[model samples]
Target: SSDVVAGYLDAKWNWSTLVGKVNSSTWKAHSVLSTTDATKNNLVGVFYNPTTTTKGNKVFLLAGSLGELNRSGVQRKRENLGLKLVVGDVREPTGSEPSGRIDWAEPTSPLNESTKTAHQGNLTEFLAAGGSGVLTEDGTLVFPLMAENGNGDVYSMMIYSTDNGSNWALSEYMTFAKCYNPRITEWEGSLLMIVDCENGQRVYESRDKGRTWTEAFGKLLGVWAKPRLVFWDVSLHLD
Candidate 1:
């Protein structure tokens, strides 16, 4: 009955938000960083590193600022937002020492603060990176990054590492108008990415251990919805 109830509700609602709510509640505090500005929202990604399991379990969170288009007829300026990575020890109830605080080891790119004259309030776009991170059976960590240029076009970069988080290699660039809310899962010895586009859901898969990706399930129903994949012995579950 619990499974049935969960399945029915998950099919109707955004599954990613539900899991995020659960994690947010149990994780004590919202580990992700947010800005004081009402227009800006934090884009976060969480994943568990298995290869480094012996050393210590690490949870990776990345955040960026999103701009809101002004309602006034005058042109509005976009503020430069920064991306921060917060690493925490998953084994312990709370992170140990600096583990709980926000640490800046590296940023995706420098913040961009510029005004949009042509689009004005029409530009409801936000720039965010790092929301989808998934662990593999072989103890590899894979995640996606959102990169935008001066033209406002969005691109995706898949980053992966075999030797834990010590070194990372970048995959080829993916062309997508607007992409966020990345979810990854390993099915039948392969890695799959469920990415959210402005229109609908797009599924990408990798065979060579996440070096690259090809569209597996093209534009599934409910593209705007974010979904998480989980594997169980009995049945495949979505949450």
Candidate 2:
């Protein structure tokens, strides 16, 4: 039997069921698990297994908007922060008894360095944004980030850390189609990038391990739709 929390409120159960029903309405959004603030206050995050393993195991990264609020009903203060990684184990349930617990890295402060700062500038001016990082079959981590300069433009680059952010290096500067969302995934044993360009989706593949990229697909679709692609079990899955 599944372990039920003591004194569970009926309203909580009802609300949970309602949210699940609404989420099931779309298949694309269904594959990816996401969390959003109830007020739709621009606080949202997502998690998924890019490479669907037989055991359905995966890792999750989160990003959200942070800032103070002024009384004008406008976002007078805001900054986007990268999602902290939560390491955990998840397994299929055999009999509804909590199958396993996913362990995640405790939330920690962003790495700060004079030359390689985390957010790039004042928290209020930066938009915390990131995507599923490139994870190699042999186990490697390559994360990409875009710094919103509070202007209409965004600065694109990758953060390479051999020792995992304790020490870091920056990639040559790249520009996106627009200052929208950016994501990274592994395909054909290479790292590929997907970004929102002029309200359209652009795909770029890096053969030399994220050093240089070549356009693979351009204007594939509109930005209103979630744009993501990954190789799962030798097949391509896109959303």
Candidate 3:
């Protein structure tokens, strides 16, 4: 049920490698994002925001480099507190690992119960794409997550903070099943989430700062995976 298509912008400033197979479902239901749905299930995601200080644009996100330590499953519901944020200078070039130019500040601060996600099944299976985390202009933080159960049921969930990581909360799971590698990006002052399926990559939008959502695409688009968006005001877009 894939429809929408998001591509990777090549070095020459051209969008290339346009393959379809990666899209994300926003909830527990097998359906796509709806204009009238709220609540969801499962936890799967990585979030990022450009934190600019006196130094520069510091990209703040949950690093995936420590994959060996972060395991998937029912333990995620409780152990999610172990997840930490890795901050890097946006001025540095992107690389698979944190390098000389880009330094990582792995904060010891963990997420509290008020911000932990609540979902159904054992979300131990890992399934995610881009750091679906973003900081809205209003200073709110949002992270879209995707999780799969042992039985093969896929789940999608949202973790957000209002007081700048002071506390966190999770959204209920929706039946938006069969979607994989969902990626959410900011555009036109709105957050757009794209879900991938065998049929196409579905699109959904959230206004009022990632609280409630609505279906953006009238129809499905394509099947693409591991999607990342290039925002304006940046010289080199790193993931």
Best-fitting candidate, measured by lDDT?
1
**Which lDDT values do the candidates have, in the order given?**
0.46, 0.44, 0.45
- Order the candidates by TM-score, highest first: 2, 1, 3
What lDDT tens digits, residue by residue, belong to model 3 across residues 31-90? 111111211243233222212211225544542212112345535432122344444444
In model 2, what is the error at residue 211, expressed in angstroms?
A: 2.8
Q: Quantify how close model 1 is to the true structure by its C-alpha RMSD in Å.
A: 12.3
Give the poorly placed runs of model 1, Cα more than 4 Å off. Answer: 1-56, 65-76, 90-132, 176-181, 196-200, 217-239
TM-score of 2: 0.51
Number of backbone collisions per candidate: 2, 11, 48
- Model 3 whole-model lDDT (C-alpha atoms): 0.45
Count of clashes in candidate 1: 2
- The estimated TM-scores of all candidates read 0.48, 0.51, 0.47
> What tens-digit string does per-residue lDDT give for candidate 2 at 1-239?
01101111123448776566456643122122223321135433332222111112644343332423333666554333433333334445567542233433444333344544443342222233444555566455566666555455665545444443344444444556253455767766876666666644556677565567776754433322333464323233233
Residue 80, model 1: lDDT of 41
Report the number of backbone clashes for model 2. Answer: 11
- Least accurate 10 contiguous residues by lDDT in model 2: 1-10
